[model samples]
Target: MKPLDPRLLRYARGTRVYLAATVALGVVLAALIVAQATLLAHGITAVFLDGADVRTLTPTLIALATVVAGRAAVAWAQETVAVRSSAAVKSELRGRLLAHLVAVGPARGGDTGAVTTLITRGLDALDAYFARYLPQLVLAALVPAVVLARLLPADLTATMTIALTLPLIPIFMALVGLHTEAANHRQFRLLSRLSHHFLDVVAGLTTLKVFGRAGAQAATIRRISAEQRRLTMRTLRVAFLSSLVLELLATLSVALVAVGIGLRLVSGHLDLTTALLVLILAPEAYLPLRQVGAHYHASAEGLAAAEEAFAILETPVPARGAAPAPAGTIVFDDVVVRYRDRDALHLSATVEPGEIMALTGPSGCGKSTALDVLLGFVTPDHGRVTVGGVDLASVDPAAWRSTIAWVPQRPYLFAGSIRDNIALGRTPMHLPEPPTAFAHCFTGTVPDAPRPDVAAAARLAGAAGFIAGLPDGYDAALGDDGAGLSAGQRQRIALARAFLRDAPIVLLDEPTANLDTETAADVMAAIRRLAHGRTVIIAAHRPELIALADRIVDLAPQPVGAR
Candidate 1:
């Protein structure tokens, strides 16, 4: 198991002040309870039983009620602060994780697990750490020490006994905690596997139905579910056992303190009020420790998740070489990109300032990888890629990427208007503020603005007519990844986005692969229109696209070859 990472401290950065405030509130609550217990014990012995005076009992009752209310109020405040902190941390981690995943992409984070796991189960695991485990950890350290100091002068032996037992919580916690990392890792795997299989099953449900094998797939899913059930149950059993052990330890320690205090009272070593206070407040101190111990497993799981999350966040991406002074040509200098356990392919090309160069290759012929290198998505194992005469390796990726626009093989359509998706591709941070039905930004609006240019790009994509027939036109809200539209419709929208950007250099990858003929033709025409006087590199197999290329650099995978 890995040592407890100090990086967990980073999650609490935005919440540091609140964490202190929350813990302080918790201490106030603990103190209130302790004070109330002390007052009540004194009242019972000094006045109620002795019947010396009813006057003194009034102060004790008031003090007890006041402390009880203070404890309740502070407890609520602590909960509110703790939840707010957890929310802030969760928000930051999720956004950062998404951005990193988008930057690294499936081509990089491949075979690890479903992306759903990264966003869903993986992130969900951290909830306990932030929400419960972390707060308890703070309380265990702060509350116990403070509570002990108060009890020390009152009953030295009992306070010391409880104080000494505090170390056992973390010690045994560490022991059992060691084994949990592996168990959590296994659980994470099962969780991801479960999600991956679910996504695959959902995505392929149509195919399965077409082939009449949905039943078989369902059976397979059931089998996976059964395995996941077994894994989950196994984890729970371990968690239950650990909880039992911690409970047992805390129970025995507190019980021993009570017995000793009882004996001391009988022998005249302790007074009645002191003994009652010890009995009442002893469990108060022991409670948080056991709760901390119980939640140790939850924290351990979260820590394991944080490890994986950090791995993705902290990973260094392939360099986007030295930034050219301004937008310059993409130069491939005898670049040889090799995949491990696969044949290597070499590429050499210079996409000049304003001429379209289409790269054609068979599937898995390093076409996408080649584009990835130019886009600085992948760095070549050998040779150099330069833009504007400076090597890409030395360039700032953001600045270099800022100079280009890409229409990937499968462009993503977000859960918003057509305008929002296009804004993502805009250059110079300039969004076209056209007087259309929608302003191309979130806050901007163009009433009844004609999206004909948007429509034109769609027309060229063979998607114009179908969209024209839609009730909302471009104003329709598409589901994430364009769930509402056909796959061809999604591609057309993407091509329209590329057209809308009108970038100096366009790097596209088979933007019309799965579209029907008419749609593909319009999409191709849109590409031609989009490519006029721009450096365009399309990793495409279509004959129509091949005809548009001034020169075709074939990246055909071979035992050995030169293009």
Candidate 2:
């Protein structure tokens, strides 16, 4: 990726504002540089050559100090704006990336660990890019020209020398940047792999210990970590080498201009003030370029990550329709879903309003695919789905989804109070017993405030009994994935959430997968209550659960070309 990739502007919001601000700041900084250098030169010459006393140089000293203060203020403002702009860009990119991931769905096969690392650490790397590199890039473009223009009036020979030697720094930078960019990209990829492997192993650590392969996995992790370390060192080495080259080139350029100014001063052809001014401005001419090269290495990783983010943003999302989904029946007319190199499902089914339908199939027989299609996550390769004679393709996805509630095989429970998990932080209208009321009634201790709708829904799902028995009642905090709750308890909570949703359609996937006989029975009772007055579709195999369905559709795996 280029040091300042154009794609960032396309993917991250507020980039143009940052660029414009950077340019304005760079111009201000350049003007300050010229003023400060001029003032300092005149002050020094007045004191040393013109034999001016301290009192005579007081005004020059004050003006130089003021110009110095102005330069400092400009630098401070530049940094403050850069920090804010970086934050805004990162926020915008993260939001867009997550939304796109949802739109594309799981069929896109994104790695969870990779995506997490990208959004968190990878995007953070952009701080260096925005806060340091981008501003330097703007300064490099503006400062050198401004400084050189000022030098031309002081000493033409020195200005000409600066112009001739300045090109070498960028020529060297371009060559070093090519190598640095490649090294940074490789390092980023390795970092992503390391993150993914670590997360995968940690998530399955229990399984590894059970199979007595934990020791082997530890060795694998060590090996991967060592490899990542080695690559990191190599990348750092290249970055250091690039920085060294740019520093050397800049120093040489400044030295050349200084030598020309000194020779002219010795020949009496140049005044002391002009020589001093040219000498001061000579280094300033190359300072921005050197800083740009230095910051480029720091920002290389972020640039690589930004490139990946843009690739995802550029992917086409499934087109959503404009019409609202109608009420009545959802018809899958000879629908077919094909995964690359394989056909996952083919079906002709109709789910009528206010009726329950069960989808039964063996593993890998596309039971889930059918559900995904219905949920608008996947599009059929052939035929179409319609609701009340209106094609699903003609119905807006968000509008269509608003009418349905879904419970997956494994319900995800975020770490929060029971009420927050159930309501997912949204305020519901229904009122029931408050958490304090439930606590007083069941545990004899008044606790936190309650979510009435959460309690009412839990009662309907038969989860209120367990929730009420807890020390904090509905106010209890649970760990990730409901660590303190049994599988049946979690299922009941999911059912309660579905009940609270009170949508026109409900879809359940293996609602009783990990439940015991008694718990399953309780969940089934809840399901029956939830199914009442709603169109329900269940992907289930349990006889009792299947029996509740008004109709059962069994799916079988079909060949690639099967009709």
Candidate 3:
């Protein structure tokens, strides 16, 4: 990323306001710096050269104190704003990033662990960029120019000297920045790899143990960790060495300006007051630039991570329409999807409303891809899908999806009470209790008073029996991704969700793929109930599941060059 990527300003609205504030503060800080230096120089010259006493120099002392306090106040204000702006910008960027990821869907969203790390720990690094580097950068641009402008009339020679040498700091910074950016990118990549690998190992630890490969996975994780440590140290070493170089250059420049001032004062070519003012302002001119160089290292990793985020956000999403979904028969008209020089799917099918249709295929023959096509996650390279002769592509995806209920082969269940997970975004179903005024009039308890709808849906999906046996029933807290539940239990919960959705169209993918015989029978029974009176599509490999369909469309893998 460049010093200030324009995409950030466009993608994160908070950045626009924050950046404007930063620039305004930079101007205020510049003015305060000049005022402080001018007052201090005059006070010192008054006391030493003019033989002024405390009583006569009281006003000068008072003005100097005021300027100092103003500078301190401005400094505090800048820090407070920086902290708040960092939080707002991160939140805005994170929100945009998550929305874009969802819009693109899972097919093209890349590795789950890598993206998880990026949105969480990855973007957190931006705090240094906003809080430290950006403020100093604004100061570097403003303070030096302000200081030089102040010195031009009082001491033209000092001003020229400062101007000519100041460029040296930035020149060296540019040179060092090129190397530092590459090193930072390398370090971030290793960290991402380490994070991804560790997450994968932990998620599969049980499977690794079953296969007697846990030791091998542990060794792999250790190797990646060691590599990450070495790269981190190396990046830090470069940052430290570059900070030293920038500091040394800035020090030499200030000293050079001081040496010229000293030479002129000795020759009586410069007055003491002017010399002192020039000396004070010269270091102030270099300080912001030097600090920018130092903070640049601190923000480098964050910039690298943001570059990836921008890349993801920039990916083109399949265009959707605003029109409502048309209802009738669903038709797949000679659809063909060619991916990576092989055909992912090719089909021609039709299903009348309220009919059950099954798509059967081998693992790589694109059964799931067919479901994705219906879900609008992927657009076919050729052919069209239509509902009652209206193009599916012309329908608003969200509106169309609202009319459909989908159960993926592996449904994701978030960490929450089971009822919340099942309800997802909708408010929990509840029956209003009798009014408080009539508290004593009821003779029997309200049937399913709290969440009658959820209970009814669970019963329809054959999940009520297991749910009632749980310690907390429907209110049981689930771990991440529905942990602490058996595979059959998870499947039942997903079916319960679909049942609750009650959409006109239902799409199920391998609904009984991993269940035991008895559990599969129960699930199949629920599936029969779910399919009745609904426009249902099932991507199935099991014979019994296929048998339940009104008709089957067998999808065989296409050979290479079969486009």
**TM-scores of all predicted structures:** 0.83, 0.85, 0.90
For model 1, how does the per-residue alpha-carbon lDDT over 1-563 read when each residue is reduced to its tens digit? 13225664564365566567767776777678678878878887887468857675777778788888887787778777767776776667776765565566445654434555765566666666666766777777667777787788888998888888767766776677667667877877777777787777775565688799999988988988898788777777888888888888888888889899988989999988888887888777877767876776776666766777777777776544454435677788989877785645588888887777778877878778887777666767889987778787787766666666677776766667664554444434211112111222334532232455666556655566777677886677777566688766777677766666666778888877877787787677777777888888888888888888877888876454433
In candidate 3, which residue ranges exceed 4 Å CA deviation?
199-206, 425-450, 560-563
C-alpha RMSD (angstroms) for model 2: 5.7
lDDT of 1 at 287: 79
- Angstrom error at residue 208, model 1: 5.6
- Please report, in order, the local distance difference test score of every candidate based on alpha carbons: 0.70, 0.83, 0.83
Q: Write one digit per residue (lDDT tens) for candidate 2, span 1-563.
A: 24467788787759999999999989999999999999988888888888999899888888888988999899999999999999999999987887677666555526767777798899999999999999999999899899988887767888888888888888888888888888888888888888999888876675688799999988988998898899889989988888888888888777777787778789999899998898888889999889988998899898888887887778787888899657888898999999777778888999989999999988788887888888887889998998899999878877777787787787766666788667741322111112212223333332233578778889999999999999999889888667788879988888887877788898899899867899999999999999999999999989999999998998976556765
TM match of model 1 to true structure: 0.83
Best by lDDT: 3
Instruction: Report the Cα lDDT for candidate 1.
Output: 0.70
Q: Give the Cα-based TM-score of candidate 2 against the true structure.
A: 0.85
Which residue pairs clash in candidate 3? none
